[model samples]
Target chain A: MIALYRVLVLVGLIGLWWLISLQVGGVIIPSPPATLGAAQMLLAEGRLLPALGDSLITFLGGYGLAIIVAIPFGLLMGAFAPVGKTLEVYVFALAATPRVAFVPLIIVFLGLGVEAKIFIVFLGAIMPILINTYAGVLATDRDLLEMAQSVRAGRVETFRRIVLPGAVPFIIAGLRLGATIGLINTVVAELYTAVRGLGGLLALYGNTFRMAEYFVIVLMLACIGVLVAEGLRLAEKRLVRWKSGS
Target chain B: MTEPAAHVVLSGVSKHFGHRDGTPMAALTGVDLTIATGEFVAILGPSGCGKTTLLRLLDGLLQPDTGSICVGGAPPRPGPETGLVFQSFRLIPWANVRDNIDFALTSSGLSLSERAEKVDEAIALVGLQRFASAYPGELSGGMKQRVALARALASEPQLLLMDEPFASLDAQSRELMQTELMALWARRRPTVVFVTHSVEEAILLADRVVLMAPRPGRVIESLPVDLPRPRWGYDVHGHPSFIALRRHLSERLRELVLTDPGSDFFQRGAPRS
Candidate 1:
């Protein structure tokens, strides 16, 4: 039922956009059908697939790395009070500052390569993952910890059974946010240097006045965002099955 | 009564929590007590009375500031031989009833089959077999506490420490749990230490109610309850000495508040136990 309503809303939005495009009668903003046509052409020419592949590779590298590093580090800071106190200020400082401010320095140091792009994505995505994970670990139910302690559950058992599962909802929320931010950073990285990926195509088409193709790339990016978020939501539902009714 | 073996001994145990302004607040002071095997003792006191602190001392969750505690001839520390049930049913929200019970068995060094057997047995013991796969969030308050009870009992500890286990339940459920607890205790009879503020509850469920006075908590009185065995669903209110003992303890607890300057004004017109 919800899916049907969602599809209806999307169709209504496209219909409105199509009507506006027809009324404007300009190449600047293409109609939905024209954008779809450009998407097909890009796919037929094999350009869309490769750019998508590149974007996915960069996105996965940065996002996966951020998750791997930030979660455990955050857990460490949260589980141990001394570590949390020492690192919390710096983490907040980094989270507070604009991530884009570091892009120039990252590109300058790492050069206009995949490494720089990955670094930019990492900088964009890492803070949400780190902060949310920290909050999740910090917010672990004290009563549950007391229960575990009273039962003499060792460190490993406590972490595995209590902390990890307790932090799942927060971690999944972080991953969803990270996915979106990572995509945005991927575009910023590519647009900055005009090097590769769908962001490069976006810039290439926009520069040449191929408005429909540019819109298609933007549409694909939106689709990718939706897919990543939907994926995380599905995984969360599976992992946190006990949190919901059967 | 036969002289049972002394399973827990506390000698001059004291615990102090640091206040923000630097003055230390004594939670428990020079608390010396002995609990014998198969004995159910209730530490009854008001809010500030450190009944919880005493229980935590025995559970080894907190170190005594100035003394020693021994359970089963060893210094107290959380181990497989002891189990603790918190007032708040601390069942893991992410785990089902069976898994919550099995969690207590994690460090027990038992094989998977043995753990499963124990977990199932405990689930049955608590009458939670129907909700064996239910999560804490899905269960009622009473069922959740039952799961907590099952979790603590799954390890088959020689000593069981319960910190106001039924305080959160509704009156009806609390009464039911009291009866169930009595039945369960009648079966295995572990060296149990139950901490609560309810005078009647203490008498209903314990062999002896150790009353602690607040304001630097210390045991001021210990009264033996001559209630019979298998007291579940028994007319505790109709017992020969029930009203007399209840009224006496009630007055004594009230007197403690009345004498204390801090509790004087507030305790006036306050509800009685």
Candidate 2:
């Protein structure tokens, strides 16, 4: 029943798109089926898959590095106030600044290669992951900490049982945000100027005035991005089902 | 059946909180308590009554301003010797029941096998063996509290401090847990200190209920409960002595409540006998 409803919605959306294209006087707005056909052509030629893969690898690297650095640092900041205060403003100031502005400098330092693209992805993803992890750590239940203390839990034991456990939900929420932004950064950096990935393809197709191909690439990217994000969400639910009782 | 010995002694224990200006706000002053090993004692008070503070004092979460607390023959320190089961269950969100219980045994000088064995025993002891792998989010209020109890007990702590462990459960579940607790007590009785607002619960589960009226969080009364064990849910309410005891404590609590805020929650002509 749900599938049928979705299919009906998709049909209606397609019909509306077809009607709009006919009414409009330009080649800019391709019909839904035409856009879908273009999308298929990209898939068949194997260009889209490989480009997506390239984008995905760089995206994961950036997001992965963010998680590695941001989370432990966030934990330290949250668990220890003085340390948090010391490092807090540095991250906050960095996060507040328009990271996009750094792209030019980053290109200068790292060149317009995968390194630059990955760096942008890292910068974009790191803040959400950092902020979320810190929030999660701070949000840990004080009562549980008391309980842990009462049980004669040592410092490390208490952190393991209570502090880290409490931060998991927020950490996952942060990861979701990081992945979303990281994907966008991958495409944005590539579209701006880069050697490989979907963004580079987008720029190449977009500049050549292959409007149909551009539309198709955009659609394919949207699907993959949505699927990856949704997949993470599903994983979060399965892995963090333990959060429900809390 | 016998005289309960004092297991943990708090001598002149006073706790003060520092304000923003570093001025002290007294939470407890000159608190001298002697908790007997294997005895179930309840601390009864209102929301601000510092009953929970006293429990924390025993747990070593907070230090007293001008006194000392000794637990299980040592000065109060952070470790599994003083187990606390929180009113809200406070189960770790990332841990299943088994892992939560296992956490207590992690640093107990026990081998991995020993830790696993202890966890199993604790789970079985709580009658939550079936829910061992279940996450905190999946458990009911009662079940979550049971996990807390199991976790606390797993380390074989000589002292257990409970802050309204049954407070969040429904009345029926609370009553059931009360009996379950009594049964657990009968088997492996630890020197237990429970804090609660429920008048009847204090009488039902405790050997002595230390009542507090709050402002300064001092003990107003220490009433001994002389009820025998093997108590069930129905039996707790049905006994004549239980009724009389409940009536007295409830009346005392009612008096305390009605005196302040000028609003009465009790009936004008409620029977005392």
Regions of model 1 farther than 4 Å from truth? B264-267, B270-273
lDDT tens digits, residue span B1-273, model 1:
878889999999889999899999999898889888899999998778898888888888899989899998988888678889888888888889999999999989999999999999999998888899888888888888899888888888889899999999999999989888888887878888999889889988899999999879999888889987777556878897778889999988888877666574454756658
lDDT of 2: 0.81
True contacts kept of 2: 0.75
lDDT of 1 at B121: 98
Model 2 Cα shift for residue B78 (angstroms): 3.4
Report the number of the highest-DockQ candidate: 1
- Candidate 1 accuracy as TM-score: 0.93
Rounded to one decimal, what is candidate 1's iRMSD?
1.7
Best by lDDT: 1
Cα error, residue B58 of model 2, in Å, equals 1.4
**DockQ for all models:** 0.66, 0.56
Give candidate 2 regions above 4 Å deviation: A1-4, A36-61, A194-197, A204-208, A243-246, B1-4, B19-23, B232-244, B258-273
User: How big is the positional error of residue A22 in model 1, measured in Å on the Cα after superposition?
Assistant: 3.5
Per-residue lDDT tens digits for candidate 2, residues A71-97, read: 998999999989887888898899899
